[model samples]
Target: MFSSKSERLFTGMIAAALAVSAVTPVVSVEAKQSEKVTYQAKKQETIEILAPTSPLVFKQGEKLKGKDRILNVKIDGKVKKQPVRWSNLTTSTIGEFTATATYSHKGQTVTLDVPYTVEGYELAIMHTNDTHASLDNAPKRATAVNQLREENANRLLIDAGDVFSGSLYFNKFKGQADLTLMNYMQYDLMVPGNHEFDLGTEAGHPEFAEFIQNAEFPFVSSNVDYSGDQYLNALYSEDLTHKPVDGKLYEGVIKTIDGKKVGFFGLTTEDTANIASPGPIQFQHYIDEAEKAVKSFKQRGVDQIVAVSHLGFDDNPAVDNDLELAKRVEGIDVIIGGHSHSRLNEPVVVADGAEPTVIVQAYQYGDFLGTLDVVFDQNGKIVSHQGKLIDVKTYAADPTAVSLLAPFAQEIESIRNAEIGAEATAAFDNPRDAGDVTKPSVRKNETALGNLITDGMLDRAKQMDGEVVAAIQNAGGIRAPINAGPITTGEVLTTLPFGNTLAVMTLDGSELLSALERSVSVYPIESGGFLHMSGMKVEFDSSKPANSRIVKAQVLKDGQYVDVVPTETYKIATNYFAAKGGDNYLEFKKAYEEGRVNDLGIIDWEIMRDYLVKLQTVTPSVEGRILDVK
Candidate 1:
């Protein structure tokens, strides 16, 4: 009976102490950029801080007594100011005390009670990048996204950009259908990926704006300037919110759940400037924009920051990849990344200040959804993180989303099921097979389809500019080759799924030399230094140093060897993907940015299709165009 009475008294004291602490006055906070205050408590308790909301915590059975001394302020983890008010806190039960904050201004005070438990709030991030309009339910990815939403109602669905452009579905539906699908999936937000601007016509923007206005969630971006771009301006105007960090306007967003604040900013790779037709709009530096947005969010009392970036995961820190971004930017909590279409079987944790930021991505074609579950403490620090690539194949499709896509699926089925091409043998098998080009009929090093693509680009470039010299085709881009028989429109679409236009760039001999060097550097590395050429003979020694392995690179002009010098410039023909260096060719990106000019009127696939039908036969054979040997 005595022990029970003692327990009751102890519990009552704790309750009284907490009530008093909740009613205490909020400190007048004047925060600067990169600076944070510490409210040290005499006890230990877990608390959470959410966005657009204020919360508080305090030591149990303790009261503010005696004079208060200002504690120190931390800036970038170092002591900056030494003047935070400290009160003497004590617990009658002899346990450590915890502290929280209250917000009070002009005598209008509100109290927030902290959750005094060990577990923090779980933030589930469902991210997709480079969807490229793979919206059909039968294909797999569309079904996977919907399943995740049903399985995890608390899920935050985000797209890392490039949601449109690529598949025949985009061209047939003009993105309206894709937007509807994303709406059904209930995407929390999406950033502008490079390919979203596939159509060179400006009229597409206004329609896009209308789509956003009706979207279930917002589209977030920090660096893309839509001020003068009337089409983009119309679409994202209302959703635009300026942050406090910099006076610059941003298309980023902040969302809250359970008293916890989370901020999301979007960034598309600057390389988009050269690849896609951004017209008059300018893309800001990725690092600069990210830094400003993070600072602005922190100023708004939002410490959990994520960047839905379209930048690919680069192994090198110098290039634009998610891994490089994590290392370069310190405060980003997580990066839902895309554009490289990397299948990161696992997530990579990058250290950000006192915590680690998670970087993740799902491979393209709706095969997977990247999930990052993060838990944060009261002080806005991440306590624990769990991430994985959830394969879409494992989940049962939601009947609702499937029903929503029924009409679109029917339309696609009419085309896919209609036989366009017949193959003598399976033309292409996936990468899992040995010695297989992407298609079964074509070998990797050389293929009829690859030759046909290179020839088509060269044929079109000659008509556009008399100076056209050489063309190159990436092995990965050619999805499949003809099986020596009848061909149909559907077969062609499957082979060249993306609506990539022809782009001709003038490259100086020096730049072309560097490109050739890169093409041959890792010759022995599978899928490394292979090239399909139309106007050049490239020979390399595999045993040579990586950076200087190109033994010989010569361009033919008028059926004779041209006296090419490093200073001389020549016109080159290729698709936009290579110009932007989609496959880790930084030199190509650099060339497109500084030297290549876009002639948007040209279309490569159309030309290739026309050329193939005219020839009535395509027997591609490697004719020592690119020779590499140890």
Candidate 2:
């Protein structure tokens, strides 16, 4: 599924694994006689090509999706030690071929059999996903893209999206930093990720729709309906699939790759509604729209189809993931996906039917670029495939990329570098307060980082708007840990990279209790909805059942902790995402429905910065704010 630069990865007991694998047949035979089955080793080798010595195999033909024809190398029992060095095991046509690898390490001579069965052939496609406005990584990604372009002149470069709202780069320039670098890479196409609408989705300040208008390439989306908003429609006019809310977004573009037509369309995730404010824009069912797009492309005589998707992928096909899409949608050849940050070393081929759907997704934050080598048979059905997730950090920052980003970098450096506060000798965990300082997890249980974030949110709400009682920050919004030195704005930005705006809402004490119950439902299992609250204390028992986990909760009022009255309404401030029912906060959603929510334009990180600045020196330690009752 994933090919990488030749490096020995200490994954598992490699020698012991091979020994058991060699005995599988005997075990199986004995099992049949005994009427019992033994477990098989799921461990895989970490062997890679040390150099670019391997030559291309198979001829280019009609292209689309199918199972990955993997070339598995078999180790002979006669050979005990094998060298790491291996070279060209090329096949111009379909057949079984043998290659040799010989190497010596630490006085051990090694020999192994490198076997190849040519079942398919190669399309060069380069893609980025969940870039998340990591400015430093963007240039490196650009460098990697350049290298990939040089290697394959006919390669297709694209982004799966979420190229917005993270780090100081986004905090300073919105998303221009990522856009400039992506434009520098000369991406052929891109889709809008959920974070693109984080700035409240109105046709107002921090408008991604307007910013997208300046992009060099087309931004396509077949499912998200922008027809309700005239501004969104105009700003995203180039998004071929925009105006028409039909399952088939009339924007599928067919490109001539080696004189073969390759169709590409975009599909945003359905979860965007729950996670972001898309204003008048609405997302359609991805599976339905994706199928319709594929049918449309097939009707247009497009042999190959690529879906640039932002719908998150999961190991479970039952969820609305790329794997699910691949299982249901047979015609889509390749799906470049984002959202959920699945790092696949090899492409996932779902062989649910006659044709397998190939799914590829790189890890988040532009650290790696996904490169899939898909081989098609004579009829254009995918016969075999190989995938490589290229590490962008390996490449140097291109000068052109550096120059293009200079202005934005300059604008941010002064403010971001300013010293905000200092820790008193102890290094604060990036809020990964999972009881283990080394591991750093805030999603479950209580955390010092969550406490600090809630305190900041509470302070900001009180300062910006009146009648704000308490604040809660979701663990997912905390991005980085602060070191035990002078904490700068840059560190704060990284720590709270989402730049979530504050939203205040009034909910009855019973509703608040319900929200807290939902927050701790997955306690100890690390749910992002885990709430860290200011001006409140939560004492829950995880041993209890969900929705009834909270035993006792108290809200701070007039410098006193009082029992939450079910009939009493309390003003609560939280990040806008959670205010709009993100993290399944149905109570908050209910309040939004009743028009009890007010979203202020104040940025979250700035609020934290102000809080830290007011303190002059901050040493946020875990207090008994949230308790887990045994």
Candidate 3:
């Protein structure tokens, strides 16, 4: 709530106490993150809450562990064998519980709050988000999940969506095989992401509704309302007594977790309209729908609430991220979110005191599994929350997941002409200029993958009907590194997972220059709009003022590099997202609106794959196409 500069600096200190990085973590189960509790009182002993970083899952019909390790008490900078006294232990029901650790020294007593979740049903709530069908990690993820399930008697698995598009797996099976594997994992509930509808309106592709109907788990969406398709209407559920605020579609549902009614609702971002073709499916406001669901849960006397959300956690407040949702509405206890590809090492608490919400998300590609252990007070309000991000690759992949995925792998191998499944001849590296992995080159200046992508687009555009001279791809579109060694279809998809179709747009030299200027406006901060180009050489100073950063620009014309002519028209190739004003490429959007941009309707992956096949062996090097003369 800081307005002035001085106030902002003061409030910044307050934020550190709540959401500080892993070191010297200071938070209690009872008090929310916003409240500043005094710990400087004289004559007090501090106790270290030493609990294991692993998730503490309790399953139904499973024996509870004896003598759980709560915490070690310390008095006046000395470690004691045990805490003076332990309080708050009840085993009658399954719910999140907390205990108090007490120690006495120098006529003063200090108390520490220790929390644990008790259960009569399941031990772990395992979830993954934004996997993007990178099935190569499927075996590794399954390995981690299976080991966790073995130790915990009861387990609940869920997904936060975007299990569509990416690798050859989705390209060949179209989400059917992804669902088959998810079914094998026994996911309890799943929500649809914007990418789930990437093929919804297209012909000859499996629609999202079809995936929903075939899915073993329930697809929940508190804000999405659609009933044109009979199959969708029959399967969709609005079972919660209270409807979402102004929602004409399905709300949330009450699922039995830990032998208790835990109200679980789903919310996808409203931006689905522009991102994907969600035919007949309309979205309701995110915060309003969440508030409505919370009200309904409270009315039904449900204490624990979990929202499986795809509403991303972005810096833009206008986008309605998970943190903003928690702040805007009260009553939600935990929010498992997706769509931003954010990997939160620890769960974040937005405890501005109105029913504090704990938010957690795993990084994309099934590389990590998110685990959040929440303890609810007697009144059902969350008292304590602990979060952990498990590295799936740390353990051996389970054989079951590998077996289940084998058939699809075989199918993809055949369709790839045995090339996509096989390894590539050379390696493509994307590292920082300082020879470090800290900051990737793609987001800042330019990398080999960015060059390769734009080069493919330019090559493909030249093959098509037009005088296409250049290609540009926003940095954000490149998802991951190609790494080294043999490149499989999986690796290629991992690098370009978005499945953005290529568009060859007509842009005059002036507009092109404007586009390049906008691309580097927020230079060092890492913007997705930063353009990677082929057939053009751009030399710019990032320190220069925005919209005027370009020191020089050139395009290949008639087999030679020449200065760009402002009035000269050229057909430039770029992705659909950039062409439609995504990442704030307004010039491209304007061109599309003016009918100057023609969407070639060519898929981007094909261009890259075809380029790779033709080359057979590639040794791409950065030769100053995008120079940062800082």
Candidate 4:
């Protein structure tokens, strides 16, 4: 240094320089630490926890683990999946619960109070089939529905069709009376049965159209083509819709229940074209339409499918049926069926495939309400199910339904109580061989009621076409019985409620013989085609084969039983239903098509009522009209 002070100053300056260099290094280190801390805080703010698309719903008694409980973490606008650590999740109870889900990502942990549900996911379906306008017990049915709905919020009330005919309610009101209560009970969906088309030919289904238009719920019909019918086509939607409007008709519908999509389609028997007056309405092949419906539902991401089928349970192997549908279709989960009027006390499960299809049907009348509770797994597959028929009569009448039904019941009461000026000598029992197969039944054997009905039909047909020789009545056409008292107009209406007109057909003796063979084809099994004779008698051997069962055939010629000449042409009378191939009367259908048949345009119940008035004191008995020998 230059001097002692200067040297000290230079030394101090050098010391200060050294101090500044060391301090500068320390400040640079602290600034970098602050920046690192700020970056860590910003990164922690960008890391957000996102819940799953589907709600975290766990089954009862299921432990929360695996990928199902994983949470998605969003980091810097990118999603990152991470397993969530859930706080003490109690799934033993079935209800809503809140729990904390801890998600950790990139050394940052997030604890969220996520809401979840632990439930059995039991779907309750309340169904009915073939109620057939039996509204006498509708109030009780409403009560049953209300009680069941109260028990479970997840429930659907559906009808499998045939709510159009069979009782005084349909006779007078043309389904309006039933509709009032059905609306009150809130039916979710309904399918049209064959009988729904009964009035199609008369007025192009004016009453049916009105019934459907005024309905509170929608209709699903996949196989029936309403496009041909002017009245129905307007309301018909060929496209499957997720949100279907009430009172409209659809090929299929997607119903969202409990955050899950359930698909529904409907099918009526193709035999409806022959059995009922569908008029311009066309019926497609059921299997084909059902396949299309399932495909459509699946394309829309619906897994659970329900078919409301009017096909019989195990009716005709030649025709379509629910059993065949269940076996053939792959994705259908449940079938609520009608037409055969099967009383499924428990659900029938078809488990031949990977998944099972459950089938249930209530009996003919509003006698029972079918209930099915299906438990679905997390994958939307049916894990377990329980189904049963609840007797409508078991429940107390609902006050609201009773109030709704009062006016209808009052009007029906007046018509039902009016006497027809005829007294029955005995109770004309319309027996069925349901419990005891060996006993005589109206469907399998000639009963007094069948004889009376056929006699009335013959007498009425002779008035229209005097040449009409014999009258044949399908036993299935006879619905109810005439009590052993003063017969009322309601009794006759209930007995022959289908509103079938008289038809006279000209058939060769050979064709008549073929008809007789067809009638007795299913003889010990109680076929609906069983012929009840008024002017003919047939003896058949039950031990013989089906088509060759007839042993002898006779026709009443000039009030005498004579042998049927195969070469001779004869005139026969039957209901329009049978004349037009109903109950598989092919010969009658042939005659109808060949212009050899004449429809009298008279209602069958009116014909029976007039015949009863003519007979004054009605005492009819079975006179060995149909003989079956071993």
Better of 1 and 2 by TM-score: 1
Overall lDDT per candidate, in order of appearance: 0.63, 0.71, 0.71, 0.82
lDDT of 3 at 113: 57
- Evaluated against the true structure, the overall lDDT of model 2 is 0.71
Q: Write the per-residue lDDT of candidate 3 for residues 238-276, one digit (tens) a residue.
A: 778333222112467676555566888899888776556
Per-residue lDDT of candidate 1, residues 1-630 (tens digit): 335554321111111112224452333333222223333322222121221122223332334443222222322234332322222333333223444434332333323333332245567888887776677532355566656668877888888887666555665676677777777676777877777665645434554555556666667777777766666664543232533122122467777754577888888777766567667567888888888888888888888788888877652234356776787787888889887666787787888455677888887757677888887665556667888887777767667767777787678767654534333233433232354333332223555456667877787778766788988867666675555456665667767766566667678888887877776565444463345678877777767887787767788898875645789987887766677676777767777555364533334555666666666655545476767655
Model 3 pairs in collision: 57-123, 58-122, 58-123, 59-121, 59-154, 60-121, 122-154, 424-487
Lowest summed lDDT across 10 adjacent residues in model 4 is found at 10-19
Clashes of 3: 8
Number of the top-ranking candidate, with TM-score as the measure: 4
TM-score of each: 0.62, 0.58, 0.59, 0.63
Model 3 deviation from the true structure expressed as Cα RMSD, one decimal place = 19.4
lDDT of 4 by residue, 1-630 (tens): 245564321111111111112241111111122312233212123455675577777777676568766777766668778777888567876678887777665545556667788876566799987776778799999999998889887799999998886667888999999999999999999999887888897336777889999999999999987766778889989878888998899998898877678899999988777656888888999999999999999999888889999987765545688888999988888998987667789999988777888899997678899999887654556778999999889788999899999998899899888998999998999999885769878888989999998898899788766788899999889999999989999899889877676777889999999999999897788888998989999999989998999999998889899988899999999987798678988988787655576555456887888889999898758788899878
How well does model 1 score by local distance difference test?
Answer: 0.63
Show model 1 residue runs off by greater than 4 Å: 1-117, 137-151, 200-204, 238-250, 315-321, 352-355, 413-441, 444-448, 457-469, 474-487, 496-531, 538-553, 557-559, 562-630
- Model 3 stretches astray by more than 4 angstroms: 1-124, 202-206, 241-250, 418-452, 455-531, 534-537, 540-550, 553-630
lDDT of 2 at 443: 81
- Top of the candidates by lDDT: 4
